[model samples]
Target chain A: MIASAYAVPSVLVFVTSALLILIGALGVISVRNPVHAALCLIMTLFGVAVAFVAQSADFLAAVQIIVYAGAIVVLFLFVIMFLGVDQRAHIHFEPLVGQRAFAGVGVAITVAGLIALMARSHWVTGAVSVSSKLSNGSGNVKELGTAVFTTYLFAFEATSALLVIAVVGAVLLARRERSTTSEEAPQ
Target chain B: MNVPAAWYLVLAALLFGIGAFGLLTRRSALIMFMCIELMLNAVNLTFVTFARTLSDISGQAIVFFVMVVAAAEVTVGLGIVVSVFRRRSSTSVDELSEMKG
Candidate 1:
């Protein structure tokens, strides 16, 4: 069993990640600027990655940081900047007009339903058996790699194919057609 | 103090609700994207909490796939935003109403 020294850091990591997540979620809604919203999203993504690490999913954490915070968000910022869209030119916020009431009622009913279901379910107190497969194995890159290649080979291949389709579709959609209007055409 | 998994689930639920509110109220495409990211992160938190409680690695594996799909989505979403901006010179969701089929 790991000592308290190891456990303390993990606890600290979880607390900080949860705090950051809440802060980021608030920032996402409160900020009016689009760039600032995207930056808040980056913070949220980083917090989530830390949470993953604390859960002993080191490989998943790395993937979260690299794929989400590193690549996807940067791409978003680049496109926002490239488009040169004015942040404040046409600001508009529609009046709630009964929608808020409807939303509140919907949320209340959903919460009531969830509470009733929780009251009825016995799974919360049921005996949980730790699977033998992961008993001794550390959730490191090595274990993940072996599992992905052997047990999850089909799923991995499917993901690759989906990625390929995404790339092709993005390329086709991103192509900008040149205007052929006779404004000194070919001059 | 040791926090229980239920606390994390409650936090995730709150974040999800906030994201949904933003999605409903916001008119900016970029803001909407941020809200979508919030929702995704909320789901990710739920995944992590379950993974911790069950002591299983499968939930983390699902999170890995979710992150991949999110990346692909952002790429495509930003591309569409750029194209919309090029045509209309704005990123407001209301302005795109004319382009609706």
Candidate 2:
């Protein structure tokens, strides 16, 4: 079938999420203020969470909301406010001549190529699932937990190490040290 | 009938393209970081769709890990940005030309 008719609810959900995502994405880049961009980021993230729900990725949808929209966007706003760079700066002042035009063309080409490949090839060929069948609906959390703790046990443990390292690195990088010499002062 | 995977795929591609364009064109390091987040979400959407198609839970598990990694990356990345902003009052990449070779 060239195109299949879909359920009304599903189509509506998809359309809603797509609109939120695209409009918010455009807002992010087009907006001059970093604060506005961060707000746009939250809108885009909520749209992603909606899509996740439509796809039966219930857990991810929740995580997407909590982790992405809640935590991540807040962190971005914190940085923005802390830096006091919340003014509405000019968005069209391109450092490189025609940089926006070139970027737009390049991205259009890449997205077109991606869609073409998907259309032509036997796209996203399904392999025999090793983990449990994505157990649907309310069971997602259990299934996800089991998979993380069992099949991906090592990877799960390694994430802890990664998080620790990241925290230490962030603290080290963000820490301010008063310079002993005038030359070392932030000039 | 339900929405096809192709539809979702196309949407993800568009999302990714938008993110890439923003990354390429945006001058602010903070805005660029937000664009990167958009790209990551697009990839995550694709992963979740494939997880449904393949009936595999591993994809969701992988998304979990991806979120963790993304969090870590943002933590370190923002720290660097803050430190850089401390030295240079501006967040615009155009101003930081000292490393240009």
Candidate 3:
């Protein structure tokens, strides 16, 4: 990388995003109201977008806002309103004994292991610009678009099929009446 | 121009850990779904970090696919949630453990 530390502005950006992410994540879990949780989720997504911009992923940042905050969270809110499950859950009820304790322990261990692994890896050759130099500014969108169209063309096309399948499957699953045997037999 | 990749990596790790905790501890299916999205974002952040570090555009491309897949997954997953809610008026995972043979 350039150095052990970056510009003060960059560091501030990182700190701000990190705060947004952690606080929003905590809010998502601890908040009893599902609707509030969804709002908090938007905060987390925006935070990730900020981090994306900090890393020069301006295109992804835009997609993050447009797709995630724009579409997905709205879908979540729609489902919550449609089902009327928007009320607060009973967070104090421990139906499963010691579940939170065990989960906390496991997640802590996993995070520590991941951090240690990253530290020991030989990724010290960081930012060598091996493939395409990610020159910031106007080049980001062009670079990402070219990669999606050229190298990942097949996968990109496959996603269209996947989206269609998901749509069909969602309709089938959420239909008001289940025919059981055949769709044509139903009134 | 940017921070060290390691900083981003560590941040993502913490994000993943938080998501994992929420997924495990939260019994509400909707909240669990949100946690899964949280974890997915963490991984996407990592991909973007590497995309910058290696100066490889492919990492960003993969993130694009991941986003598409995530959207599709949520669509189907929420449909299943709606159907399940239709059968039982509650959204808690504790009530859906009937298949534990």
Provide per-model DockQ scores: 0.46, 0.80, 0.73
Off by over 4 Å in 2: A1-4, A86-88, A137-139, A179-187
Report the Cα lDDT for residue A80, model 2.
92
lDDT of each: 0.70, 0.88, 0.89
Model 2, span B1-101: residue lDDT tens: 55878888899999999999999998899999999999998999888888877889988899999999999999999999999888888788878889842
- Tens-place lDDT per residue, model 2, A18-101, is 999999999998888899899999999999999888888888899999999888899999999889964645677776899989
- Highest lDDT: give the candidate number: 3
User: Which 10-residue span in candidate 1 chain B carries the lowest summed lDDT?
Assistant: B1-10
Across B1-101, the per-residue lDDT of candidate 1 in tens digits comes to 23556656666776777677777767778878878988888888787667666665556666767777777787677767766776778888877767463
Candidate 1, residues A50-164, lDDT tens digits: the string is 7766666778888888888888778878877777645673334455466655765675566456545644673134334332123333555665566667666787788788788
Say which docking band candidate 2 falls in.
high
DockQ of 3: 0.73
**CA lDDT of A170 in candidate 1?**
75
Instruction: TM-score for candidate 3, please give it.
Output: 0.92
